[model samples]
Target: MTTTVRIATPDEVPILNAIRTSVRENHMTLEQMADYGITPEVIANLLRTTGRAFIANVDGVDAGISIADSAEGNIFAMFVLPDYEGLGLGRLLLAHAEAFLHATGVASAWLEAGAGPGIRAHGFYAHLGWQSDGLMPDGQLRFVKSRAALTQIVAGG
Candidate 1:
């Protein structure tokens, strides 16, 4: 029942994509990913540059993933295998990604989610302290977390 999160290796596009495509929510296929310029080479180059990906393993098996765009201060993606759901791997991976962004000096970070509140990720992000930031021009929901906001809230501002 032990879970671990680690920075994904440079060539983990296949593993990362497998976990991504396996999700029923926020579902995306290989072709759809490619259509969005998320090809394997692009992912690899991102890993080598402005993006960082984290893989979560449960009891020694790869079960989930999180990716962040450092330059954009965005949580680009997070996904857990259906078989690995409910074990809190997604939360752990997300915390790790957020920690990475914080370490890199981002005051705020954001991630897009499905349009409806009924989507599991909507609740997940909300539960993790991400504030709803309304919809993107393309209609996706944007959620953000800000260290500065947290500081202001803590100061009763």
Candidate 2:
């Protein structure tokens, strides 16, 4: 199967949200996700504004998504369909988001990982060399990565 990652358009917000909702490990139901501000309208606005969203398609099917808020030096979101996991799509999307943030002159990027059985992101971020920076105001664990460190990691030393 072939995979392609590309900038996501505003029109793809629904697909992005769908992928996010399908992740049982997120520990959030559709209603809860909306309460947490994961609505399509919010995502669409992000796509239209300072955020950069990328979609990963496998065999021409929407499979994953990654989003970054360059202005805030934060990874706003990243999700892959359960069926598409273990295919390196998440890593690819993350790399693209980090590159985009670095290109925007961001020195560091951060993201909040929820605490629960449904939250499987901490290990993934940790595997990519991100460090935990304590809890965010919202109580989620904050993960951070620096551009310089990422550069060194990519350079293999």
Report the number of clashing residue pairs per model.
0, 1
lDDT of 2 by residue, 1-157 (tens): 9988888889988777778778856656668878977787887887788788888999989999889897889988888888899999989888888887777778888988886544678889998899999887777889999877553213111
In terms of TM-score, the best-performing candidate is 1
TM-score for each candidate, following the candidate numbering: 0.91, 0.87
Each model's lDDT: 0.84, 0.81
| Model 2 clashing residue pairs (backbone) | 25-118
Clashes of 1: 0
Whole-structure CA lDDT of model 2: 0.81
User: In angstroms, how far off is 98's CA in candidate 2?
Assistant: 0.6
